[model samples]
Target chain A: MKSAFRQSMAWLHTWVGLLLSWVLFFIFLTGTVGYFDDELDDWMTPQTPTFSATADDSLPVLEQFLATKGADLKNYSVSFPVDRTQPFLTISYRDADSKRQRIKLNPYTGEELTPRATAGGQTLYRMHYRLRYMPTKIAYYIVGVATMFMFLALITGVVIHKKIFKEFFTFRRGKKPTAWLDGHNLMSVMSLPFHFMITFTGFLLLLYTLMPLIMNAHYGEGKEGRDAFFKEYFSRTNVKASGIHEPSLELKTLLERADAEMAGKPLAWLSVANVGDKNSIFEAGSIHKNLSDSRDKWVFDANNGELIKVQIGHESSKSFYYVLRSLHEGLFASTPLRWLYFLTGLLGTGMIASGMVLWTVKRRTKAIKSGGGSFGYRFTEGLNLACLLGLPAGIAMYLIANRVLPLELSERTLWEVNSLFITFSAFILVAVAKAIAKKADSAWVSLTFLTGFLYVLVPIVNAITTEHNLLLSVLNQNWVFVGVDAVCITVAMACFVLGNYLNKIFNVKVNQQEHSAGPDFKRGHAS
Target chain B: MIILLSMLIMFHALLFLLLAMPKYNKQISVFPKRDKKLESNFRHVGYVLLVICIALLIVDNGVGVGIALVCGLLTFLGSLVSVMFTFNQTNTAASLIWLPKKIFGVISSSSAYFYLVGYGVLVTSFTLFF
Candidate 1:
């Protein structure tokens, strides 16, 4: 009975892991990249200077802008140029049409600065959960479903590892699927805690979108009901306008009063509602100070500067949500902690990538034994190779395009995004073409080389087109540019070593010789 | 600085745990021959080193951040040891112990005493730095 149960679990693990592993791979890889989103944002928007202007200096410009374009804005917020996250003072509000609007302002001169446009790191971060060219609601459901399967995979994976403790330090790099299995198992077991936490938090993040019926039943249906639910869900408050025109206390005064309450945390952003009304309320928030708690908020009366409410901690259920959110986003991490998050994220991503390859490689053996694989096997391997290498290559192209593309080009941001998807799709197409021609082995080796080449090309193009070259960045102690260049070169070297390894194992001539000798299991990797 | 030290200790601890397994005992062959007493000693020592690593991190950074760092570094160091075994990089693993022994001038030439001295130095460094 025990053996049967284990067998069933193994079956379940394989299928569940195989079915969503592609989408999961994409989700994991993009989510891992999201860790350095801020640093990448700095690198991409090079023309934007690092602003160190004080809040007092930037407030008058903010007030002047608010008086003009913000006349009709009932609820607007100002983000101070306090730190690396958003290094320039900015004001954001929803327009009459209810679409969100934001503008950047020069901290010292008060002039509007329009930096060179690009689809920055936020887009890539968003692409992980929101996906691309699709409605967010739909993407949420897709990512939500994937997260559920991932959680299941982790559970079944743990159950199936009979030698869990004994094999904790085991990874034998021998033969095709054996090595791939070791890579997969080592990654999975080593980071099991992080994998579980991230997957659970990721699913929790999408819970409202996934099961809207529970909220809908209580609050009614459609957009308004969802908004109402969310307001209550997040413990948000609203103030009624007195309709009497009275200019509230200066923004500067309100912030100073709230300063002591913030407990040394940097100012994140603040909002004022009812603007000039007598009963206007203001809200100030601080950036995250720890892992479990996100930014804290202090709500006050804009007219009197009296603290109305302070949300330092929450009740149990809400606190649980906050902790999950904090762990998922990891905004509270220090430099070393952030690297830990990143490396663990890469481990999780590698787990999924290696699992997919193992599944395909195992099947390839059987398909060969049966006298050549069906088109499905060929296509799957090709797609696996495409994703494992092509996505990184596409990302390298995205970085290069940011530097090399014409700055004056119209819709430049959109083109930058397009370049990534186009390169990725072209690689897929080429892999598919070779799969159809029965030369998938050669395609894998060549594409691996090409991906490495593209990554190596990134820093070269950056040096040619930008003044923030690696050498200058290092000399100036501009760690952002230096980090980006160093990581690119590191990734390129890894790819080259991997390409060389695959080249040795999946050489076309060797594969062709094996083809003449009947179906074999010697080809390395997905080939 | 503290994190790197903690990670180094954690990595060595995991390596000891790996070497304790009889399969790994033969596979790595870091010692002249695997003694039952030595493997048992390694097993206990590995757990002890892990505890010391956690304590060092806690002393360096307060509990809240310390625990978080320990959790992350565990996955990282575990993977490092696993990869070492995967690629049969046992010589590289042995050299880590060998260098520490030579540097500290082992009163005893055993890997166990060498690690103890290494830990002593690490704790001293942590104390001085903090």
Candidate 2:
């Protein structure tokens, strides 16, 4: 009975892991990159000077600056720099033309800093779950389905590995099928907790989108019902604007009071609703620690400095939701813990990539015997190569383009994103062509080399175009740029080593073939 | 510092468990005569040290961060051990016991024994100093 169950699980694991492996790979890669999203954002926008100022000190400067912009600036928000990654105060307001405008200010001096336009790391973070170039709802549904398959794959994978504990310490390198299998097992088993938690929490993050029936049933039909449901659920109070003009208390005082109420947590953002009205409400939200949204917030009556509502903790159900969401996001993770998250995320990416390769490796002998494999076999092999090497190459090209592309080019951000896809598609084309020509091994080796070379160029290009090169960044203690450059070089070296290893293996196989079948063996084999 | 120390303890504990296996014992040839009793005791000691390491990690870093760090460290150190075992199969176990083998000949001959004692001293010093 146990054997039968294990067989069934093995079958399920194989199919589930193979089917959505590419999407899962993409998600894992982008999500791993998302761990350093803020640092990446800082590096991408070089014009924004790194400032060291407290939110308490910056609040008055931000308010004084906004006050000079006139009373017409309504429905605006001011966000203070919470950490080193975000060193500038952000003020976003609806202009007189009713178009939203946001500007980053030198937190200490309130001088506007115009950073060069780029899609930024937020796009990469968003792409992990929402994807790009589609209705976000559809992307959510697709990602949720992939997340579900991932959960099933993890469970079934565990169920099938009978010697899970024994295999935890077993990894045999330089072997063909077993080596790949060992890698898959090693990464999966070693980081099983992270895999399970990340997958489950990822699914939970899209719970409402995936299972909307509960929301529909509870809120009833129509937009009004949905708004009402959100208002109650999110603890959003609807305070209408009283037309009578009144002076409001300074933002600094309100921020101090909110900080005290939240036990000294730094204020992240402040929202002034019903501005220039008698009943204006000032909402001060603390930095996100262990929740999707800032859980600790204080609302004050703007007209008088009277405290209105203090929201420190959540109800049990909300707490569960927030905790799970935060776990997936890792917004509260410290520097070392965040690095751990990033590393494990990379391991998960490797696990998925190796699983994809293992499928090809397992079938290589049978496929070769069956006259160069079926269409599905060739297609999947090509796709595995394209995705594994091509995606990283594309990301490197994107970073390089960010540095080399003309700063004042129109739609610069769009071109940066387009460069990624263009490079990715080009690599895919090369892989497909090589697969068709029966040079898949050579293709893999060359593409790996190219990827590494391109990655190596990222730092060089940055050094040429940006003043914040590795040396300058180190000298200035600009760790974000320094870290990015160092990681790029390390990844480049790894790729180069892999490429050299593959080249050696390919040469060994070729030499063996020639020895077995004479000098013209290659021509005959090609035929 | 605490997390790194705890990871070292956990990695050694896992290495001990691996060494305790009869197959690994024969492969390394550290023990000419394998004792079943010693193997079982080594396994028990490994588990106990692992528990202690995990407790220290959790106390130092909170539950969420601690568990994540341990998993990350396990993945990293496990890979290192696998590579060392693959390339330097014979010397890997001997290298861990270099100090003890030089001092106490027969007592430190068994890699499993070395791991057990190493776990004890490391855990004791970590607890005392850290």
Candidate 3:
């Protein structure tokens, strides 16, 4: 009786987990991609040349820009080139006379590249966190629920499995339900730490959402309280622009001096605020790379070029928050750890997808037995295929769109995001159609093969589009490009192997009773 | 904040233990029939809540040794309560094994209230003082 009850609980846990699996999968996939968002952006916009100069070299250009666009100098920021691919150093400022007047200038040539706007890959990054169409608060709430479910799934999964340790080293790939469970278990358990960290951090990161009652009770409803809190916590105080017009101090020399002061630290960004003002500050922040504990900004006054503050030196609660943020983002970790994080994220994605697929797979026999094959099966069948294959197809097509689409095109970023949804939707429809034909496995195999083909062709497409050969990129130690290419090939190989296995599994029609047997007691099980 | 948090944690711990007791109940295993729906629902809810609590702990990223002690005590109480409840409902014939269950339950519950009140005071003090 107790065994039967245990089985029922196991069943409940499985189905509930499956219900939220797709959303969880998307969250994991997008989050994994976001881990390498900076590198991906660098890859996508490869036109920017390497910027090796300090702020001193770019001061003249900035000075020229300030003189030309002096009317729009209120609250401006200058970002110096951080990496090799960044083109022109940038400066953005608003005019003092009219706060509405905004200007952006290239510190290298004192030319304007574009105005202030948020779009492109940046949109995708935001979408992962805030979601689309919903207000940030609502989106965060939705994500919070999903993260909560993910945690639930992980815990219940451990509880329901009696042989977790025994099955740790087990993977019988060709078996039906066993194979699916093994895939789910292996992926989920192997990256257990990563899974726990991601889910926990993902929730804590959005604490305001889960316990909005705290805020609502304390700050009242809507944006007023949030705005007030943010202002108090993050905003700088006592800002008065100097009207004195002096030739812009050498920003490059200031940068050199700051770097020298630090002894040896790679720069992250250089921001010149209040340009052409006596009190203007030129801040150069360092990347916290390859170090367990690292400081960020080394700020300097742009006028006399005196060191104002180091971010690490600040004793504010705001400064303390950065350490936790960095730990969560893996920003302070070494490159190897970053890759580990990325791979673990992928495993997390797979864990979600497999669990979802397993749900539909587990239900298929029951559905067929109950003769519920009319619409419910078809709907579920379609949903499964769409989530499993459609998402990857969409990602591939988005990358393809970035390369093929014209650079000068308006709303290019919108198109990229739209293309992802469109391609994904189309593939889902195709999967649905194929599923109705009672060939769900075949659809999966075919789509997996299709994804593999597209991925393998990615490098070829890049070469055709950018005229940058893989060999050249590899030789140049262009790891970002090369790494992307390698990932594509690896994904393709995995798809090929998975497709072959799925083909055989679908052809076999074992008895339902025979399939559901707990385990083969005769087989030697490892503990 | 800490008091409210600890109270919530205590409440969840009680609920989880009560729910988990039946499945792990050794005595109930031989009872010929089990309530499948109740068992499954209990397991499902318990699993979900445990995960959420763990996540909350991770995200809270609490400070100092005091926080650690509180968390550790909460975990110990939770697991102990569940174990004791399960053992009591078991078919154990040994008096030695059964003796601790009653004693532990009373002691744990009494101490739990103290922890809760202490936590509440800490939170109230912090909020009012600074």
Q: Tell me, per candidate, how large a share of the native contacts it keeps.
A: 0.63, 0.55, 0.00
C-alpha lDDT (0 to 100) for residue A113 of candidate 2: 90
lDDT of 3 by residue, A1-527 (tens): 86886787777677668777777767778778777776677567665433445555667886677577554554556655654324457655555555544343455666655521214355555666787667888888878888888788777777777866433334555577877777777676656655776677677778766776766777676789766655655544335667776544665677667778666766655666666777677777665542233456777777777787765534555454554455456665335445656767777787788887787777787776865366767777778888887888777777777787787778887787788889888888888888776667678888988888877777778888885558888898888788877887888888888788777565554343455543553342632
Q: Which stretches of candidate 3 lie over 4 Å from their true place?
A: A1-9, A50-74, A83-88, A95-120, A163-167, A216-220, A235-238, A242-267, A270-284, A290-310, A313-321, A366-374, A508-527, B1-130
lDDT of 1 at A97: 94
Q: Give residue A348's error in model 3 in angstroms.
A: 0.5
The CAPRI classification for model 1 reads as medium
lDDT of 2 at A175: 80
Per-prediction TM-score: 0.90, 0.92, 0.68
Estimate, for each residue in A1-527, the C-alpha lDDT of model 1 and write its tens digit.
Answer: 98899899989999899888878988888888898888888889887776766566787887788778656877788888776677788888888897998888897778887778989888888889998888999999889989999988999999988988765676777666787887889899888889988999999988888988999999889999999998897878687888999888877789898887777766778898988898899998876767545657999989898888998867788888887787887777778888899999999999998998888788876876765578888888888878888788888999999998899999999999899999999998998788766677778888988998998999899898888889999999989899999999999999889889878877764767668755444444338
Candidate 1's residue-wise lDDT over B18-90, tens digit each? 7777787675544546677767777787888899999998877666567767878998888877776666566
Highest TM-score: give the candidate number. 2
lDDT of 1: 0.82
lDDT of 3 by residue, B57-127 (tens): 44343332223323343433333343344345443212212333354542222232343344457545655
For model 1 chain B, where is the 10-residue window of minimal lDDT?
B104-113
> In candidate 2, what are the lDDT values of residues B22-100, reduced to their tens digit?
8776687664467777678668767877887877777776676666667777777776776677777667766544556
lDDT per residue for candidate 2 within A1-527, as digits (tens), equals: 99999999999999999999989998999999999988888889876676766677786677687778778865678777876446688888888898988888888777879888898888888889988789999999999999999999999999898778877767787788899999899889888888999999999989877887778898986677678778889888678877899987766776666666767677777888777789888888777654434477888887776888888778889978887777888877778778888988999999999999999999988976786688788878888899999889988988988888899999999898888889889988999778766678899899999999999999998898889889999999888999999999999999999999999988997788668778576777888
DockQ of each: 0.59, 0.49, 0.02
Point out where model 2 deviates above 4 Å.
A73-75, A222-225, A290-294, A519-527, B30-33, B90-130
